[model samples]
Structures are given as C-alpha cells and as structure tokens.
Target: MTSATETETETETATDAASRPAPPLIYDGHCHVASTDFIPRQFMEDVAATVHRALEAQGAAPPLARLVDAYAAQHQDHDADALVAEMDAAGVARSVLMVPDFSLRMDCPLTPEEMARRHHEIRLRHPGRFWVFIGADPRHGADGIAAFEHAVTQYGFEGLKLYPPCGYSPSDERLFPYYEICAERGLPVFVHTGPTVRSLDYEPAHPMLIDRAAREFPGVEFILGHGAVTYFDVCADLALHRPNVHLDLGGFAGAALPDGWPTHLNRAFRLGLNHKMIFGTDWPLNRMTGGLTRLVREVTEGTEVFAGVRRREQALILSGNLARLLTRKGNE
Candidate 1:
C-alpha cells in the first residue's frame, strides 16, 4: 500500500511525463454539422455499410454496429452547443464549419439562405470556437451566385466550399463568376477533390481541374478537400506548382487510416509541402478520440510514413500552418 503523498507524487510524475511531448494546438480545419433535415439518408446508409464491411474484412469486433449507431446519431443532430462542448473536451481550439452542396441533389428541402443561416447561428453562438463557409452550386446558375453573395456579405461567412461531385468542373463557365466573387472578396474556397459516394460525375472531382482554375484566377485561393487521396500525385503537383492552392487533411484517415497513409504523407513532406497542409478531424464523421487522437499518436511518434519528423513540423501540420492562412489574425 502507498501513502497518500506517494500516490500524489506518482500521479504528478505521470502527468509531467504526458505533458513533456504534448500534441499541437489544433485548429480543426473542416467540420460539418449536416442538418438533420437535409443531408442524404442514403449517405449515412452507405457509410454504415462501408465501415461494417471494412471491419469484418479486418476481423474487428462486432462488425461496426456501434459505428452504425454513431452514424445514425450524427445524421440526426445539428446541435452547435453540443459540438462546441465536444470540441472543448477534445482540446480543439477552433473548428471551421462548412455547408455542403448536397442538398439540391439529394432532394432535401432547404434553400441556401436556410443552410447559411443555420451555420451562421453556430458561428454566432460559439464565436471564437467556430467559423463557417457557405456552399454554392453553379448549376443553380445566377441564382446560386446571388445566394452565395448573400451568405458572405449578409452572414459574414469567411469562405466557400464547392462539391465538384455536383457536376461542375472548377473551370466551368458557370462557376467562374463565383470564383471571381471569391477572388475579389479574398475568401478561400474549399473544393472537394476526392471520389464522392455514388458520384454523378467522377471526372469533375479530379484535382487537375483545380489546377486550371488556380492558374486562371491567381488571386483566388483554393483548398483541395481530402487532398485528393488516391490522386495525391496530381494534388501534390498542383500544390507544388501553384501558390494559390492548399490541402486539408479531412477525409484521409477515413474510417481508420487506410494503408499507405504514412507513405502518402511521407512523399508529400519529402516534396517539402508540409506547410501547405491543414489539420481537420472531419468530425462527427470521425469520432474525436478514436480518429483524431489516434492520428496524433501515430504521427507524433513517427510511423513508417511520418518517420523522424520534428515536433515543430508536426505542430505545423496540426494547426500552425493553417493559422497563418485563415482569416482575422489566425496565425497569432
């Protein structure tokens, strides 16, 4: 048996050891609170099925039923206060939220104004902990552009998020005017670059399309969402070639880190582009402790892919670099 003083000392020693190599200050660069009303039910179903299969294939316990339950819960709640509380618990200093463009396609009944309003409310409620980006669909044509302007100017939204899976290329004429709006306003755009679930036009989601737009509108900054995962080679090429493009690590650690993540990241870091990256938990979609916590552990200790990276470099990946790029004295 140990005395109370000894127990206290031992606990303090453990705490000190844990604090020695602390995780970086995180600014979660992508978080979505897809409305319980609008986001596709099918999307959740597909996700549950995919993870269930992945678990069974790996012989993981119980075949992802708990994951399915979590997905169901995520789809039903658009609660901002809860999200902020979760952020506090997870040690995330701030999170950037975005309204997605899937509403029109999935037959969800809501207008751009409604979505923007909801996201803006979250921002208002948790001012420092949250910032928001509104989505614009070029297919809605001039009406879409009008709504996007309203979102930025009316709601004080800081950015735009586009889904190419909605069937418009970055270079399409329909989207050019929206890009112009972003350029003149100095707002960064987060464009989805990976394969979409049951996508309508896969080619439009290609990362190369962004290269064209980046060249054409040099004033506008673009963020390649998911970092184009499998198409990372082209994505890296774009980042290397263009000063206006950046990548966010939102979906890469999808449903658990897929094999080769370290290799993919190693190549990117080797190419000397770590500063162009941002950390995003892709929260709710990814549970904080399981995914984000695991990532912090793997990367900090140097996995096969992240071997021997310095602490400051890992800090940069986690949030420091993102702070420099985002709005309103973020780097400070």
Candidate 2:
C-alpha cells in the first residue's frame, strides 16, 4: 500500500546505511581465556555459593552442586574458538588474555607454567587475535622468576598479570626481579586495582599500593585493571600524576558503581584521563551483561559515553593507547 515515493525513500536509506564506514577496530586491554581448570576451584565455589544463597532466598533455588556445575560449564572455553567468534562479532581486533596465579592462595589444577602453556597454544591457534600475559607470584622465588622469564622468552607472552588480591602488594620487594625482567623486555604490567571476591585479600589490591611501584619502575607501563569500576577516583588520580600509569575499563559494565559507567567515564574525560584509559570488557566475566557487543556499542555507537570525549580521545581509549603501548614493546 506504500506510495512509490515512500518505497524509493526506503531503498535510498538502506543504500546510505550500507555505504556508511565501519567503526574503528578495538583492542581489548584486559581479558581471560575462560577455562575452569585455569581458575581456582574455591573461587568458583564461592561465586556459586553466593548465587545459590541468593536464589534460595528468592525461592528459586537449584541444588548447590548443580549450580556449581552450571557455573563451571559457562567458562569451559579452553580453546579460543568461541572467544574469537565473540571478538569478530564485536569488532575486537585483539585481546590481552591474562592468567592470574592463584597457586599460592587456592587450589588450582594447573600451575602458573601450565596455564601459560595453555594460553600460548591458544594464541598460536588464533594468530593475530590474542596477546598473552603470564601470572607468577614472586613468593615462588627463583623457580617462579625462571618460569615467568621462560613464558616471555619462549612462549611469546607479552605482559605480566598481577593479582594483588592473592595476598601481595604491588610494591612488594619480592616482585622486583619480575619487574626487572618486564622492564628489560618493554612489557607492560597489569595489576588488579580494586575489590575482588571475598575469598581474596582485597585490601592489598588498592590502587594506591601501585604508586610506589610506578615510581620505582618508570619504564614499565602499569595498567590498573577494573580502574574504571571501583576506586575510580583514586585510579584516575594516579594515572593523572604518573606518566607510567594507565587505567582499564574492564569491569565498568558489570560493577554496580555509584554514578554508573557513562557518568564515571565522562568524569575521567573531564579530568583529562581519556588518553590513559584503555578499553576492556573482562570477557566471560561480563558476558551476563550482553557480552562484548553491548560493551563496544556503549562507547562507539552513541554520543552518550563519549559526549565530552573527542573522537581522537575515544580512539585512544578504544585501541590507540593499547596499540602504542603493546606494539612499542613488540617493536623493541
């Protein structure tokens, strides 16, 4: 029943849409290879128990064992096939996949070395889709340092993943040797910078704890994971003062922050922290919140999140900064 003029207009609009340019590709600054064996069983149990208790309170309870099994099943992507599909759909050009060392704090099936190997294999399979970071607790002493060096020199890992909540401060002297290796290789270090699950020691992971290390290792870039979620004000302050410090928006989508993600991001932009901000979805961690596609669209599709942020600054956050940081190391 449409008139010829209206039908013609519809066709013209479709053509215009098709002709529009694609958005710039993104480089996820923080992510993980979601394999249950790589993670601590106690941590998963704690998460499932919390969910089970909440469901029970709501009279929608499933058995605890079933809930735990379901949770474990959700993170069984030992291979990067599913991750690459999600990345392609989300237009993510690459992701930095990190393995957190929990051997000292919890019971994990694979040691840090084994976990690194698994990630290296996945990277080999995916070609240009991933950059791997090996986790090593300095408490492991000489053996740990050797394993980390081997991962970097032999396995092609590019960065260091520090889980401060695993009961160590970022500035702990024991980590100096590891920092020395990273500095020599021009690799960046990603430190968990906010509260984590109750099973871990959250106090040791404060953003301020990284200040000393940032000062000590001026050449090594320090990225505060979950920086845009909790303790954002402190994280922003640190990034503003320290040239070596940066922030990653990994848990921004899922964390129940005070003013929400867009507001927090806009505030950071207002404070001129846009250039130091890095895009990250934390992958399977935030999949419940519409996955990577939704996170990308939130920053790129509209002017809401980037209203005050200029296009160039937005690019810096989405991929430019991470590219410059990682590629600089690779080139050297």
Best by lDDT: 2
lDDT of 1 by residue, 1-332 (tens): 99999999999999999889665588888888745654666666666677678678888846456776677676655757666766776677888887787765676556667878877777777777877778888888778899999888888777888988877787777888888888887788899887767634678888998887899999888888888354777888788889988887776666234556666666666667887887776776656447454664565555564666666777887787667666433312
Show model 1 residue runs off by greater than 4 Å.
Answer: 1-23, 49-70, 255-263, 288-291, 300-306, 328-332
lDDT per residue (tens digit) for residues 170-208 in model 2:
999999999999999989999998877779998999999
TM per candidate: 0.82, 0.92
How much lDDT does each candidate structure score? 0.74, 0.86
In candidate 1 the C-alpha lDDT for residue 271 amounts to 66
Q: Could you give me the TM-score of model 1 versus the true structure? A: 0.82
